[model samples]
Target: MYDLTGFQRDLLYVIAGMDDPHGLALKEKLDQYYESEIHHGRLYPNLDTLVEKGLVEKGTKDQRTNIYRITNRGQREIEARRGWENQYLDESATPT
Candidate 1:
C-alpha cells in the first residue's frame, strides 16, 4: 500500500467504495473529483498495477467492460492505512 502512488491509492479507495465497479464508472467518479478528464491510458494501466499487486481483482462485465473489486488484502490495507492516519489526526482535524 505504501508503495502505491497517490493516484493509485485514490483509485483503490474509489474501487472499494463502488458496487460492481467498472472502468468507465470509476473514471466518472474520479473525473468529477478531479474536475477534469481521466484518460484511459492513465486509468487502465494503474488499474492493472493494482491488479498486479493483488489489491484488486478484475473480471469481465461484458465484452468491452471490465469490473473491479477490492480483495480482502485490499480491504485490510485500507483499514491499516486508516489506523495509521488516526494516530496523527484527531476528530477536530479533518483530513484534506
Candidate 2:
C-alpha cells in the first residue's frame, strides 16, 4: 500500500466501496469524483498494477466485460490505512 501512487490508492478505495465493478464503472465513479474524464490509458494500467500487487482480483463477467473486486489482502490494507489515518485525525474530522 505504501508503495502505491495516490492515483492507485484512490482506485483501490473506489474498488473497495463498489461490488464487482467493471473497468468502465470504476472509471465513471472516478470521473465523477475528479470532475473530469478518466482516460483508459491511465485507468487500465493502474488497475493492472493493483492486480499484480494481489490487492485486486480481476474476473470475467461475460464476453466483453471484466469485473474487479478487492481481495482479502486489499481489505486488510484498507483497514490498516484507516487505522493509521485515525491516529492523526479527530473522529469528527471529515475529508473535503
Which candidate number has the best lDDT? 2
- lDDT string for model 1 (1-96, tens) is 999999999999999999879999999999999999999999999999999999999999889889999999999999999998897777549666
Q: Which residue ranges in model 2 land beyond 4 Å of their true spot?
A: 91-96
lDDT of each: 0.95, 0.96
- Candidate 2 lDDT (Cα, 0 to 1): 0.96
How does candidate 1 fare on TM-score? Answer: 0.92
